[model samples]
Target: MPQPTPLPAAWPALPTELDGVAVTPADRARYPYLSSSYMRVGTPDLILMARDVDDAAAAVGYAAGLRAAVGQVPFSVRSGGHGISGASTNDGGVVLDLSALNRVEVLGADLVRVQAGAIWGDVAAELSGHGLVITSGNMGDTGVGGLATAGGIGYFVRAHGLTLDLIRRATIVTADGAVHVVDAEHEPDLFWALRGGGTQAGVVVDLDLEARRIGEDDVVVIHQASQQIVDDLPGYVHAWGDLMRGAPREFTSFLMLQRLPDGRHLSVARNVWADTDIAAAQPAVSDFARLAPLVQHDASLMPYSGIVPTPRSPKVGQQHIQMRDALVDVADRALGERVAEALRHDVASLVELRSLGGIVADLPAPATAFGHRHQEVLVSLWAQPRGIAAIDRAWEPVEAVASGVYSAYTSDTRARQAELAWPGETGRRLRAISERVDPALLFDAGLTLRASAE
Candidate 1:
């Protein structure tokens, strides 16, 4: 096993002035445990569990003071701790655990204020009682802060838009420890970064999101397509894109490849229809039903909240999975075949291509940090276990055909590959923003700017 890195000797002394705050080793252990996505294996130097926004501000103040002296600061705000790349953890640094700050306020029938620490499942369940559901992560275990900031893609994306698109306002604590409310009218630049830039700019404490009413009449269409149709999957995907171009705003669909319990590969199509009669929505999905024999088709009316699943605690020795994201104007049938061929060799490998038109493409590029506005499809490749060889083999074929990649889905080892993911001017702008916010080259775990030869 590799030895963990040691903390710097000049690291700032843990603040003892915090009221109602605990900084014991056991408390720090709890911080690492809050990470539902993955485990760091190594413990952090300290864990500050904040009860409110002021407590969070104090934590950031301590880190900022440490950076002033040490010339760098390594820390993260852990909310639901669902950062797939383990961006919320550092080998030797402070971790501000915001899970205790979970709170939700329903401002109106169409709006709500959610604390950063709240889980999406909990938020969805609360909102469902009022006949409201905001566009959130597909998995219920995702944190509000991480998902909202990192560009949320969920079942409702086709109908409503990404989670950030539904956000009306946000409260963030900056590098200087000042807490500010940001929206279209206030601190707009930081607000722009907060939407998609995620924790890169600051720790978002609260967010006000635009909610839509989705009742029990809403239908979640789920269908299973077999491996045999994998050759024809791209054509079906293109057809779905064409359908989206003409479909009503109430309908949205995405594709997924899952390894069944029996070790056989299965493709799933999840279609969400809001307010549209199932009879009316059936025609749009007719092309998918025609491509292959369906293993299971459960398209029925249900509450939007019913679709999200509760998250389990992080398991020990969980394999590190490498994920890659890309935007495509059209699904390349050749690339789909190549991915299918790769999966045949490695049963655990998978590829998911989702239609991305509807409301997603209508949003302007500068509307949020999520840059792939004009894309018609979103492609993602995943490989489990931490080995370099396995991940590289799984990604090679897909990378060959992908046009642009999503920065959030990438791995720490492939940080340099970000240049390839968000290429040219976009990559340069992200690097420049990283330099301005984290100039000392701290927070260099997953993706951070390093001095380049100019």
Candidate 2:
């Protein structure tokens, strides 16, 4: 993990060597791999390495003054930089780099304060030492700011609600550069919007989140398996979905239909038990194992931090990785066939399916800006796109039944419309809030939805 220093209380002088908060042209090359490898996109003309809350506010103020097109802002906010879409970075715009704002401190017995740029990996590692946990994304290297504002889906989804559910309050720098610590009792509307809302309103400095015990006593057993599917694929997929839906909330699973680096076609299932009680978890795990006998499995009894995946930084080179997502109910029979056929014809494409029925679906659709609570699964299709049209075609089958797309994962071209990322009444409400709060568009990081609009 990178060491982060605190900001000074009063104004210092120009780009000081102490905190190194300000990024001049000379600093760009050192921070090249801005985020973990998801895609090779975006190159900012100017990068403001914010050292603290004040620096982040100043960066947003400077960018807001750039004066760009009618709809788009001239700057983008980069927190974790794990966004699959290159929204954090831009072709020729400025980037409000929040990396140095990484601070995680336990405020009380049940609450912790985390800065926007803090990585989930570092957060989890720190919490494990304290015997505490917060539901963040499955990947450790994901940024706290990006997923918290967007919907944060994680390994503990079955036990805890979405990551945003744990957020008690947040400190944000709005377009006008004023700092506001918002919560349900504070700025109620912004608080509501911030929960699972897109990052279109402002730059979040740090968040105060509710914490839970995830000590060794709270051991979680995870089973992961993958193998070539030599049998009937459609029936297998439906059976897997059915088994997962009927299982206990403690048992959450993710399935990936992909082509290996070799020519083999495979479907992988990674299921988890959210409790320490092994006997109570065995039945659900057993039912899922029957869905695919060919897949080899692995199980573990470990703490919450143990489940965080290894480093998720991008690879050495910039590769063209194109991905799309859809929130859907149970897979239609035809869609399964389409996926199977697609898998056979194009081994290069992959489909990832994640279960969503635990606390995620239990929440009201209007509770947050995440529009897919009614959905049972999220199907993410990946391809090394030759072009946009081809990627669209491969994703069509799943999208036909899509409730909506997950804003954090999809490309700007795919999730551009307000309705696509946040559907129904949620879309209308989000835009109204965004328009009211930041009309000048200071924080319009892609897949934008504002709970403030006319």
Question: In TM-score terms, which candidate is top?
Answer: 2
Distance (Å) between predicted and true CA of 111, model 2? 1.6
Task: Please provide, for model 1 over 130-210, each residue's C-alpha lDDT reduced to its tens digit, 9 standing for 90 to 100.
Answer: 777787767787788777887787777777888889888999887667798989999777787777766666889999998
Task: Tally clashes: model 1.
Answer: 0
Candidate 1 residue 368 C-alpha distance from true site, Å:
1.8
Q: Where is model 1 more than 4 Å wrong at Cα?
A: 1-10, 27-32, 35-42, 70-73, 215-246, 258-265, 312-319, 344-348, 420-434, 441-443, 449-454
| lDDT agreement with native, every candidate | 0.67, 0.70
lDDT of 2 at 229: 59
- lDDT per residue as tens, model 2, 1-454: 5343322222222333323554433454654655222454655545678887878777766566554322353467778877777677776556788877899998978699999999998888777777678878678878898888888777777667778888898998877878888988898778777776657657788999997775443334454444535366677667777777787887778777876556445777666776667788878776766665565666667666666774756522264666778777776455576666556535236787787787787888888767667777777777766776666666666677776788777764433444677776887887777788788656655667542222
Question: How many clashing pairs does model 2 include?
Answer: 19
